[model samples]
Target: MTVHPDRLDELVRAARAGGVRGVGRRSFLRGASVSALAVGVPGLLAACGTESQVQTAESCTSEDRSAAEKALVFSNWPEYIDRKGKKMPTLEEFQTTSGISVTYNTDINDNTEFFGKVKDQLGGCEPIGRDIITMTDWMAARMVALGWVQELDMGAMPHVEANLKSDLRSPTWDPDRSYSVPWQSGLTGIAYNAKYTGEVGSFEELMTRSDLKGKVSLLSEMGDTMLFMLLLEGADPEDFTEEQWSGALGRLEGYVGSGQIRRFTGNDYIRDLNAGNVVACEAWSGDVIAMQYDNPDIKWVVPEEGLSLWSDNMLVPNKAEHKANAEALMDFYYQPEIAAQLAAWVNYICPVEGAQEAMEQVDPSLVDNPLIFPDEDFLANAYGFMELDESTRQQYDKDFARVIGA
Candidate 1:
């Protein structure tokens, strides 16, 4: 949580190279040949949180099949793993050492879409055929609240118990992360192609500036985009009343009506931004970092209002076919050496406590990178959006859809 001033200064100097290039659709694992373009994520990720779909009280029981079964399945976003050719080095090693073959699937791009696919199965306590699934914070919270995931046997996960970052320990949804573990954390902020526009310092400026009008795109995700609007309206996102939320939504409607905002986006903004068709947009920190590598003219901004913070978490779906095997994979990833390797590749804030020290050995330059290892002062300027319940989540999604014309 503390970074030395000298180290901070040096990192700042290095960061002038236009900050770190971020990861694409974090947790994304693809065919390795795909040159990870800029960040692009579906709004379905942000759309998760509504409990109106289906509800269930049945809990999935875990049985130790590890004695006979040596296989597990993991589904995550694309382009997230560390690799060498077609083989994932870490996963390969995990397989060799633990004798657990992994069926890794990068099919999870949208949290809501994935949930819809399995909700029927999970609601009935039927095996979803997957052992582990990575989800955004809000979606994971919804699953845990519905008892759709198994409570992790922490006794079998000493590495995780010892290595989880302190700040992430007590989220409002999962006080102890009993049913989830943070996979990676990211910031939602402003990203602009500087070659076409000057510094777009604040969300208010981006929303109203003439040149940026029709060229600006806000994120489709409700929490990430609406929270910034709430801040601009002088409301605290972490704890806001229904009235405050209404005011924020009203502001968004005005921009859309005025044609100042082009459209709502997930990952498609990356293509438009690269082609210079879009001048500025609401962007994720990891995506901006990744884009900067390809074009230094690309810039990420932490608006005066503050950045929205979020985490993608890992969970064991209820009635998973291989719970113990999934836990083994979870424990293996908690190893600082492995966590650092993944963090170095993905370019998000690592959630494992000791990964920073391990980062020194993997890539010394990233040791002081603020994006990878933000200290207290930097984190102070970031805030998470208001947590939502069933009725509120449904209403907010409805409101957001009307504004975005989705």
Candidate 2:
């Protein structure tokens, strides 16, 4: 639940020196190693079941015991919160102020893998024992569609209602954000080693520039990679038709066939880019930020095509006994001060709006770090991928997998 402060400082130093790197939040979505890439799509498909497991409040009733129990259980990704040894200073403050006993677990590695672990119970409208579970947009969308999560009392989480970034407030699947709240967000864009190449400008250049041929890499995740391809083909990624998807896929296939692409990658692209083996590639914001500390030549660019904006969200599953308590925790973190502390440590985009100003006190160095605290204009070019049904998603993932040599 917490990291030692000294350990945290050491991590910052090590990351700057390129001697250590924490896993990018979605790195596990593809594979831990390139050799294991083939299994990634299949794993995701297994989580996106064919049949709808939809439920209603009447069908799966839940009780709120926060009035008496004063306890909450939360599961999140590793090192996601600000910490000092076994104590989370911000969370400890919440427990003290609200009288809510908290149990936090960092057990989420891969979204689909975590889904597999809880699907049977969630499908049956049973409690998954977690009051709060953090998930990426697609997985959250799937769970919300399945009716496996509970609607939040938005009025009760006033901080979240007030501070959540406008860009993240309206995901297609939960347009009104009735069931999910973002924990953190980041961008997917162009990253290049300045030592090896001139500034790479856009997705179009990454795909067609002869100078970058056989030296560039793309992310292996379908949504992150294909979104850019869709943009290149003049298709809106948020509302593309099947024909548009095929066109994008065809363009990607052409690039691959021409040997213009080095390989599709997970976080392993960091290794190749650092060694100059990969001159330019599609990259995550957080990884590029860490790499820059060691290699100032490692540059991140908001592509001419646009950026892919995504988040890890928090949701309360159906039948969770501590719904109110979980809501309280969500609200607590949404407070700008607490949000800034978390952002200072995790270095992801803080989803709480006023956190940038609050960072003036928490860590002034990060106050202007665009990767961690981007303004609205900087985020204007960002887009989210279209939501899809299970069958369509499965087919698309399979198509992407085959082309990427997964």
Candidate 3:
């Protein structure tokens, strides 16, 4: 049964607050019975009560070959995966050997919208009908807290355990990766047109320089933009609080009122920077690489105050149908050779530790590119945004929407 859009948002907000698994026990049983009647699948309904009901990777052994044989339905953002001429060898090989059909879909257009669409089904006892999905770090953390995501069985993903970067291994959101795996990472920092603004040494310079009064832009994303602002304000990103958030918002609103911002943007900042309409703007590290490839004059800077180091993570929705196949796909991408090819195409920071060395063997130049492999010193100045509680998130969304919409 489909969920109403408005109710879905409420459920997500509730899930974020209550934790995905903390729904009242009686309510869970009721939802399961209702779902059984709606789907008319009694056997599936029988498996919907306690933690035992959820399928762990180990449970999908030779005994459950039939269920595991079904195709894995994977979903992610557009252009996030590797593909060449309609062929994905990494995926194709999994299909060839594992005898599991793969339906890779890019249906996630925005985080809040995706959360709204699937939150209800995931909150219920039965399967959410998706084996795997990718989402940004904060959203992934929310899903994990709600217990709407399954704890990955690392034993089934040996490649991931061996090859994933140690730094990415123990994120504050999901320490030890109990719920998610980083798909790729990058920094959110300043990107400026060299022709318009000689050289940007700091974020403050980019925002307040007299010459760039109305030509500066910042990201429209609440978490991304706020984290950068907090860093510039000298707040510790790892332990930011509501008071700090309020201060950052006040500073941002001041800049907005003063005509210091050209506009808050997403990918549009890329085009504007290229056209020289914007002298400086907030930019993703990977996007800067793309822009520089086209025009050498555009430069990305990890601000002196620091930058937000972010990642998009892969997670298994609670009670996914094809759990084994999904685990296999996760392992497939972690293989260094496969990961190298993906990094080459996407140009994001590879979370696979050895993927860069593997890529250098394939194409030597990628080894020294700072954007591809941010140096230790550069990483020293980067920080991950702390996860906010439900109340804080609402406050952030309200403040952010007003700033952007105004």
Candidate No. with top lDDT:
2
- Lowest summed lDDT over 10 consecutive residues: which window, candidate 2? 23-32
Instruction: Note the clash tally of each candidate.
Output: 13, 2, 3
The predicted structure with the larger TM-score, 1 or 3, is 1
Residue 240, candidate 1: alpha-carbon lDDT: 97
Q: Write the per-residue lDDT of candidate 2 for residues 285-387, one digit (tens) a residue.
A: 8768767878999999999999999999999999899989998899999999999988887778999989999999998989999889887788888999898
* TM-score, cand. 1: 0.83
**Per-residue C-alpha lDDT of model 3 across residues 1-406, encoded as one tens digit per residue:** 9999999998889787775767677889999989878888766665895442223334422122326366788898765666777987677877887788989888876677788888766655446567889988988877776667777779989999998888788877788897788888888888889987788868788778889988988887777888877877779877877788779888888888888898887556778898889989888887777667679999988787887888999898866766677788888889888888877766788888788778877667887776668888878878887778666776778888887665
- Candidates 1 and 2: which is better by lDDT? 2
Give the Cα lDDT of each candidate.
0.84, 0.88, 0.78
Q: List the residue pairs that clash in candidate 2.
A: 3-85, 4-85
Give the local distance difference test score of model 2: 0.88
Across residues 268-290, which tens digit of lDDT does each residue of candidate 1 receive?
A: 68888888889999988877887
In Å, residue 293's CA in model 1 sits off its true spot by 2.4
Candidate scoring better on TM-score of 2 and 3: 3
RMSD of 2: 17.3
TM-score, one value per model: 0.83, 0.76, 0.76
Q: Each model's RMSD to truth, in Å?
A: 21.9, 17.3, 14.1
